[model samples]
Target: MADNRKRRPINRPKFHHTTFATTKLHEMVEFYEKVAGLEPVHYGDEAAWLTNDDANHRIALLALPGLKLPQDKGHTAGLHHTAFEYESFDQWIDNYLRLKADGIVPFLNLDHGMTMSMYYQDPEGNGVEIQVDTFGNWHASKEWMWYSAEFAKDPIGAHFDPDKIAEARERGLSFEEIHRRCREGEYKPEVIPEVYLPEFW
Candidate 1:
């Protein structure tokens, strides 16, 4: 018999996928297909599995007919949100603009010190976070998340205007420079967006 305690460092498992059960399965699937850049590898009425890259499926949608919304949301114990990370700032910005053109916009955008994040809501009102590691590498970003004073101060981070950030990118500002400006409160919008809380009906 192997002793699990023999392992010095706790082995962390890679997050392979997330499954969501929804009454509006089709709409939820469509939302993932559009917002997450995912495609249905094998889709059906009752269930659908989707992926953006090769590792089989990254998102699974299960249909539950005649489902009732909990009496109160944002208080239920379940998955709050799922996040997808883009490889580069340009890619993230481009995606944001593309979605904006498609009439989809993030409800909230924040610079989490470690990651510049954008939050969106699906058709089923599920929250989704799209992020880019501002430090441009996992190791540095992980370190910052662990020890950076900025992150320690306010973990939720400061809000940023997505439109202004897009404009800054168009005007040739580097990702690091833009991140600094955002952290220093250069692009706060006149009317800050409210954090998304699911409605009753």
Candidate 2:
């Protein structure tokens, strides 16, 4: 008998960049720069292009007037928001302080057993994610399904400690360093301990 399970596709399109409308383009630029470290590599009077150290261009900031912001409950139309990855826990901490200084309170903070994240809404009410992946974060068993759920859910009211974050900084690691280590195959990921396991050893 032949196997009934569906086979994975040979290739899927990789994510490139996404554009979001904003009435506050200039303010948004400053937000992304100070918090996310996304540098604007290209721009026009009304539109700006931004890239992180990883991608050439990962986000586009578009100017829109007379636009309705998303409701307090959820996003109203178009792209909800884009999330960007950080290299280490320390990066998130520094960014967190900067966010507080700007009077932006995070909508959510969570530990999904894979990543630690801080969620915020942009000035225009778009979702913005700042996350650092735990080692061996991916669920090898159900890659696509698990991956989708990880980003889709809101992580509001989650608890995290600042001391752990300080430890990462003490080690002198940055997001750039993490990415570099990953690219060079120097970073070895460790499996996260299961939150729930059978009692019997």
Candidate 3:
């Protein structure tokens, strides 16, 4: 019998931005402007659209007058986070330093085999990620993530000290070398503990 299975299209669809409903419309807008470097492109009484580039808008904020969304409790279902990518390591580091100077600190920093990421939360407790790929091109990064032995060994990724990365940059290390050290360095791989696991048969 000939095998028959549906395969994904060779040209996959690209991703657009994410939208959030919030009570603190103004505050959220300000937070994105200061922290994410987004600019408001459209504004309405109950909605606003922001973007960092020439695209129509990368983030949409819709006002929810008196409603409050539940936080990420064990059983709650909602967005985990939305990530934005940087074009270069210099841009990523510069953004990190700028945010740090503004008193915004990331809750987590991880070095996935294919990328370096920093995660933060907005005032409304919405998660946001800023990242730069170890490989400059998306196609290359995706290929590495799919087939890299290091990623296969530790699928969850490893914790990286953001300060150490900054120090390395300050010492004039090349981006390629910095990324190499991160992938092979002392950082421990993150693993999910049994405590957080759900019971299954």
Candidate 4:
């Protein structure tokens, strides 16, 4: 007799930061700086701490040898990846274009009804998602995610093209309009790549 969709954690814990173990420290640092806009807080050859805000460090990339990389085509369970959000659609588009110009692109881009997400592969084969809320605010987004029939139909969402999204934004298409068009399959990509599930070694 109760509304289950409205149920949520009473005290949601805030995400602090993420850390990664990698043998290629320098490459990881560069990738983080470009992708996450993070700068070094305490950097060294063996370990480095990076942050984009006052948190001191949002991500830590450490150097470790003799570590086996996650096997492709296997189900590995440890950490999938970390996601970072942008407040505005324009800002999100700019970041996408910047990454595209630098030859860094997301492997998967989806319209999840509530959010538009781009998933990229890090230097260590880790996934990094950059997303923007389609609804502008968390309150609206949460409501939509909870009750929208569109979400219930296909939660995996419609795959789209980043270039097409950027063009739509640049052409003065409203965020609402773009999202609607996306759902209607206007910007759908010809081919959507299959996400690789890792195998714990």
Best by lDDT: 1
Worst 10-residue lDDT window for candidate 1 reads 192-201
Model 2 clashing-pair count: 1
Kindly state the number of residue pairs that clash in model 3: 0
Model 4 over residues 1-201: C-alpha lDDT tens digits? 976785768899898889898977898899989997999999997999999999989999888778666565224566666888999988998999999999998888888988999988777878888999988899999999999997998998988998999989889999889989988889988887765532323
Q: Model 3 clash pairs?
A: none
Q: Which regions of candidate 4 fall more than 4 Å away from where they truly are?
A: 1-12, 73-75, 197-201
User: What are the RMSD figures for all models against the true structure?
Assistant: 3.0, 11.2, 5.0, 4.2
The candidates, ranked best first by TM-score, are 1, 4, 3, 2
List, residue by residue over 82-165, the lDDT tens digit for candidate 2: 687776666666777767777865655545434666667666566687877655344542363356563356322234433344
Taken over the whole model, the C-alpha lDDT of each candidate is 0.87, 0.61, 0.78, 0.86
**Positional deviation of 14 in candidate 1, in angstroms?**
1.9
Higher-lDDT candidate among 1 and 2? 1
Query: How many Å off is the CA of 12 in candidate 1?
Result: 3.6
Give me the candidate number with maximum TM-score: 1
Model 2 TM-score is 0.61
In model 2, the Cα lDDT at residue 22 comes to 82
**Angstrom error at residue 197, model 1:** 2.9
Query: In candidate 2, what residue range of length 10 has the lowest lDDT sum?
Result: 192-201
**Residue 120 local lDDT, model 1:** 88
